[model samples]
Target: MNTIHFTNLPDDLPVAENEEQKKQELEFLKSAFQTFNETTRHLQESYDKLQERLNALDLELEAKNLELEKNLQEKERVKNYLNNILESLTTGVIVVDKNTRITTFNKTAGIILGMTAGQCLNQPLADTGIQPLAELVQSSGGQTRMEDHEITTRDQRQVHIRLSASPVQDPAGHRMGTVLILQDITQLKRLEEEAQRNQRLRAMGEMAAGIAHEIRNPLGGIELFASMLKKDLAQDPEKRPLTEHIISGVKNMDRIISSLLLFAKSPEPSRQQCNLNHLLKDIVNASADFQCPDNVKIHHDLAVGEAVAAGDEELLRQVFLNFIRNAVQAMPDGGSLRLTTQTGNTADSRSHITVTVADTGVGIAAQDQKNIFNPFFSTKDKGTGLGLAIAHNIIKAHQGTIDVESETGQGTKFIIKIPAWDEN
Candidate 1:
């Protein structure tokens, strides 16, 4: 407004200053670009390192997972394998933890103890209701391990058992629990006793046979003389009874001697297919011959199927006749008699023919039962006492077993098992 001047005024303005300002702005932009490039490079390097670390962790985790699964599978396989071995043992096996809790109970153990796994497993052994086993384990007077120890069951069956106990230990040898092994030996004991009895009887039989022969010679002469005397006294009626008494006494003595000889004899049984049902029926029908009373009732349950025995028919007839006669004699006051026949399996699962004779009568005493098969051990007031002994010997010869069960007043049962007739 006051009259402007043209052209170059001051060197500090416009051209030179503009050039310097542009130079400074270019330098600052360059410095800022370099700083941004360095920051981006550092960020990229850190991301690469983080990615590598994550990938390494995933691989380690995968391997660890595979090993864990493999260990789980191995453990399961071992558990099942152990379970199978525990189940198949015939001897009774019972395992209890340190806390006295039942951990394992096998099938044979269940059978012998008369209990099931559901009733015993995880329970206290003392509370499982097997008192004899518990007493043998827990009682101070009892032994933890013993052989051929005898005990009575709740069902009143006497059992012989061989038992052993051992400690269960962990892999580290720490006491974990106790394991008990048991075996039932009642049959073996009975067999041994029978063998001993047979040996004694054999010796007695040899002596009795000799004595019987000696007596028989004199007995025959006595009977012959009595008969002659009876003939001479036939006309004298007063002396007839005296000669009759002598003859009667001689006849009785002869009968006893015959019985003694019969008991002493043990012939090997002649085997034949004898239908036990038919044989028993015949004996029952002819029970009158054995003096079966009119007041006594007889019941028969013969098997519908064939119940055949492998023994001599004549011997079987005699054995059954003895049984029926003894049964009739036992029930003097009139009671029931039951005869049954069945084809079945024995304890070891062998085929057998069972003949049961049960009578409601005055039963034999428990003490007397132990000696009932011994010769000259009579239950009757007037008997030779050789019937049962002879019957026992005959059964043994026939490869059969005879057992008697009796109580003082309850009743008596005779069980006879013979080998079933096998064509093979």
Candidate 2:
């Protein structure tokens, strides 16, 4: 192999003019080739470094994509779990966008409003046809929290509902939308009204007790004087008849006063472990004097198990007697009076004995059911309206509960539950 050396080139060689010029050009070409080789070597090294950097970036991008996928899956799972919880909740929940369009509605909200989520979503409140709710939200001015609003449904059924709405915002405080929560409070409202009624009845009972006591002594003396006056006027037949009528009327008023006194004076319960079945039998026998119409048949289903309760025997008897009397009155034409006893456990797992008095009679109207226990509130003209009221008070004093269920013309059932004493 022949290698060209730059230093070996002749500076001035004797030759023809053309030959000398060619030699100079050849030497310059050799020098330029050496500089080109050095440039190529530098570029090859830079290309190798760039390829390594590109490979590193590619691997980093793959890792980042995998991490993003994992985060997305986690977020999806969390969203589904939260959605399931919201759907299962009993309280109704609805979310609306800033434009008043429905964004989300849970299953409970759908059921409560009598519409499906698909029908409600993305629709304006007005278009949904819930007029009361739409008007309320429109009046809220983007936010409202209302408690215990009474509303009637399309079916004309009254309901007490609580509403709460708050504006939803993003983390940076940007207005997003609104969230509404709804809760049914009809039963709670009824309970509050019942408590107030019971308070008033209690006050009345106390006052009646004082008045009856003061009037009873005078009434007894008057009855005695009237009887004596009638006996003295016996010789005068016309006068005797008039005096006897007065005596009889006065006696009837005195009897009513005595009964009022007995009701107002709540005797201390002589509590003992007593069989409720026996007590119920006694009540049935005593109620016969009320002259229940012939069409009314009485049936008893006493539990074979321990039908035991710790309460005053006489008071409990009176309670059942009052209930039976009411049932008889409800069915003027007569109906079936079925008495049943069952032993069960309470929600808290405490043992209880339940006595039920059911009647096939003209059932109480739903509107009047809530106030049935209020004193002086009665459906019957002949009733003083104190029977059921006093019965309720007696049951309450016994640490028991009396619940009634009735539908108009269907029937009425009263369940009295009393806790069983500890079997110590």
Candidate 3:
């Protein structure tokens, strides 16, 4: 602190000293005022500029916040869209981590696999009971695509599948897991098989036609001569055996020729409203005298009343006769034969009569089942192999289908469908 001491001369001082002191004080005050004004002006300008900069920053911050919220909403929308697509896909989609634990099993996947998404998620791929998927995980090196891979389900139903797999990776190319896409192709596979079968049948029919024409004339003469020889040697026991052998051989050849012709012929069915129940009864009665094993038993489950079908009675009779004969022959060891007939509607809403011939006999081998209806294909040593083929043709001519269900050692069932009489 600076102390200023004023002498008594300040009240009444000498003229030079007083005037000088007063002038100096006045100059000092003017200088202080000028400095204060300059400082105030500088501070005001700085404050104004600072406030303007803060306002600009506030505006920028608000804009950024809005933009950030918009980006977040857009990202959320994209995420939902992707999720919906994954859920809606028909192909089974499965995603697993590097440890082979399932992360995502979509709705289609759950349905096709006979499992729920909740049941499969977090479960190991190997534990999912899907061998192809597990194999994909084990063999996953890079992207892989497989088609028409067959798999049997837990219920013993076979399914054909197509699979595509790729390893999920990050931006740095580190392996994360696998993404698998599965599609069911069982129906498509059946169509292909049917197409192939039709082609083979067409060719076989053409070939059999020429062969039947060449063989039938000779076969008729042989059968005639054998019959005459049998009549001439009827009294001689030793010669009778030879004649009988000749007669049997000729008869067998004639049957073969006849079967071949029947298989090759495309007969236009003379459609009629025939009662299937009566037809089936007539078939059973006609076969009553046919030689079957003594122990063999035949049971009937024919639908009562009018089991009417629209087809040529003769052709249908032949079809049923062939089926019944096969059933009887199959039960060589004296097993039961069930003949069932019922009325039903097909998938296209057409009424049809279904006849099931199930026999507890030596069942057809799995490998031979597909070719059972093909010409010249038979499992029996004495079978001409043309009976079922002819029966198939007749049923097809009537716009129906024949299907067989059999497993080795489990007997066999033949289901024949013939459209019922529709007046409309």
Candidate 4:
């Protein structure tokens, strides 16, 4: 255990050394404080600038989001408006995918096709089983338009359609689908056929009139000479029979000339409102008394109570009488004759009177039907064939229509439609 002892020094000894050490220690503390305060101020300023920049970015983002939302709403509204327009169109529109499956079908398309959109949707064209549309699509070759194409429906009704097809494509020019437009032209086609028929009849009437005039001059002399010869042969029984035959031939020729004259000179209709049912009944009564065969029974079925039409009385009477006589003559082996009258509206919504004379006899052939109304065209083994030609002209002058429907071994029906008079 060693111990050492030290003596205490005076307070005033080595003052410079002590003062220098205290000054160095105080300066070090001041420098550290200044550095700490400067660092704290810089950190606070940096944090404030970062927060301001963040707030500005948030406002810009909100503006962009609002603009985007507005654009989306505008696009949605445009899409709805286009859809409405498409649905309102009268012409049929059909859209198909690349695989030939129907994608869109408008209301008119459904009506024209006789199928619903739901039934056709997402189904292949061949699967839809519409032969006309399928054939059209195949012939279209995905690029061309076909116009005025005629097709018969499932129910055997004929239709005229104008079709146009175009291929749908993406921005990259790849075909996406096909769009088809169909327009109905059935009524237009009917009107055209009527005009053509009328023209042909007019030409034939003119030609028949000229021929009749040429034959009449010689026919008058033949009739006069035959009558003189008949009087001379009154003394001879055998010669009298030959002269009678000559007279009968002259009378037949005169009747043919009269028929040709009637066909060529189309009289203007003096239209008056008349009871069509009563007129038809009178015609039937007259026919039964004289023209109609005793074996052919007549049936009157007037469904309409007040069947009336605007027409010339004399001309219409002739038309009805001719129809009845033809119907009675058709039934050589004793068939029934049905005369039906009714009031109905036409396709254009016009009220009209309709008369149908049907006969249960051997029907007319299809090839002969087309020429039945033409002058000098007849199947009957008789005198001239001008009865129907005259009848057609009379009906046409009265703004009426007469058509025939017949099938082999079935029966024959003649339909007459005349416009009704609006007394009001």
Residue 253 C-alpha lDDT in model 4: 82
Better of 3 and 4 by lDDT: 3
Using lDDT, rank the candidates from best to worst: 3, 1, 4, 2
Per-residue lDDT tens digits of candidate 1, residues 165-238? 67777999887777778788888988898889899889888899999899989888988888898898889999
Task: Please identify model 1 stretches exceeding 4 Å from their true place.
Answer: 1-48, 135-144, 152-157, 171-174, 215-253, 268-282, 287-289, 303-311, 342-353, 362-371, 377-379, 403-410, 417-424
Off by over 4 Å in 4: 1-80, 127-132, 234-243, 287-290, 303-308, 330-334, 343-352, 362-372, 383-385, 403-409, 419-424
Off by over 4 Å in 3: 1-84, 171-175, 227-236, 288-294
Tens digits of per-residue lDDT for model 2, 1-424: 2344555546576577658777777877776777677677777888888889989998999999999999999999999999999999999998888787999899988766667888888999667766656666666666665655776654455678888777788999887887888887878987897788777776887888888788878877887887899888878887888877877877777766765666676656777897889887876675554555789999999899779998888788878888888888878888899999998898899888999999999999988998788776887765667778778878888878999999899789999998775677
User: What TM-score, over all chains together, does every model reach?
Assistant: 0.74, 0.74, 0.75, 0.72
Local error of candidate 2 at 304, Å? 2.2
Instruction: For model 1, state the Cα shift of residue 93 in Å.
Output: 1.3
**Candidate 1 residue pairs in backbone clash:** none
RMSD of each: 8.4, 7.0, 7.0, 9.0
The residue pairs that clash in candidate 4, if any, are none
What TM-score would candidate 1 get against the native?
0.74
> Candidate 4, TM-score vs. the true structure?
0.72
